[model samples]
Target: MRISVVIPAHNEEAYLPRALGAVAAQTLKPLEVIVVDNASTDRTREVAEAHGARVVLCARKGVAFARQAGLLAARGEWVAMTDADSLPTERWLERLTARAGGAVALYGPLRFYGVSPFEATLSEQGYRAFLNLMALLGRPNLAGANMMLLKEAALWVGGFPEVEAREDVLLGWRLRRLGPVRYVPEALVLTSARRLQGGWGPFLLRQVRNLLGDPRGYFGEGGERER
Candidate 1:
């Protein structure tokens, strides 16, 4: 199936290049690379264009809206979603597509870059445990940074809700109702540790809060400023 990789970016001038470069390096290259510029005041559009990514403008201020815009514009049979601050492994796309095997969606592990080794290990292990638990409950543990889904499946779920956080997880839950959501442990993506600026303790606490209740982790800070 043809794949379109969509990246929802907001003021990601500092990190867009790395994200785009990783897409370009994918073993199974995408049919198209789309970068949804979410009202970025920075050079996000220009940078995306420079990397040969089609720039889709979303004046709306949230990642959810930006993602919906990209999904609407995407023409590929499958959609690969990643954040502007994340770096997919060279074989990320190839592995995901290979393992799709009739599944409607796929999600994998994430390893944070620019973080201490101890922190990375802890976070990775914790996330894996969470994924396992969710699987037991017939729910999906999907991260926007490393997920692939059928474009038709995403549209069927009404795209992503215009919420501040947990939109990825919400989308996954809806998709699961239609068909299987595959887990790919080796198709890892390296994401920015910028979110941990306040230190690991608070960052982790905020993550739990995001998972348990409303997501005040990422979008609550006003989309553009944080990304």
Candidate 2:
């Protein structure tokens, strides 16, 4: 199956190289790598082009919009999404493709990188605790930092929401209704912990609220509610 790796970037010149390199080095190379530049004022586009990634200019600013733009342009049957600051293992795509055959969507765990000692400890502990809470509540909205979906399934669901945040969760909820949404534990992606550390309290508070179904705080007005 052809797989397209879509990365939504905004002023990520510093991290784009590493992320792209990881993609290039994947054991299961994607059919194409599409980097959607979200009106970046930096050299994000140049860096992506330098690494031979097909760069798409997204006039919009939000991650959701950029992701949609990339997905719409992707030429692969399967689309895998990752952040510009995240790094996937060499076998990440291989594992994802293997587990995605019977499911409309597949998501993996995200490990934090470049975190301070205290923040790392808190992140590790808190992330697991939150997962436990989600399981207990029978909620399985996975993070978008490491996810893959069949293009047909995404199209059938009318693509991702046009919100600023929490679009991944919203999309996951919609996909779950169509068929099984599997969580592949073997495919792990490492994401930077900058946002979590820079605004720990508020970031977590908003996450808790989203988990409780208050998605408006993350998506602003006119956003769809979680199913």
Best by lDDT: 1
Clashes of each: 0, 0
TM-score of each: 0.89, 0.89
Every candidate's lDDT: 0.85, 0.83
- Residue 87 CA error for candidate 2 (Å)? 0.7
Model 1 residue 199 CA deviation in Å: 3.3
Lowest summed lDDT window (length 10), candidate 2? 217-226
Candidate 2 lDDT over residue span 1-227, tens digit each: 89999999999999999999989989998999999999999999999999999999999788888988998999999999999999998899999888876898888777788976776667756775675566456555667778898888888886788777778877877787788787777887888987675577898886787579664633555465544
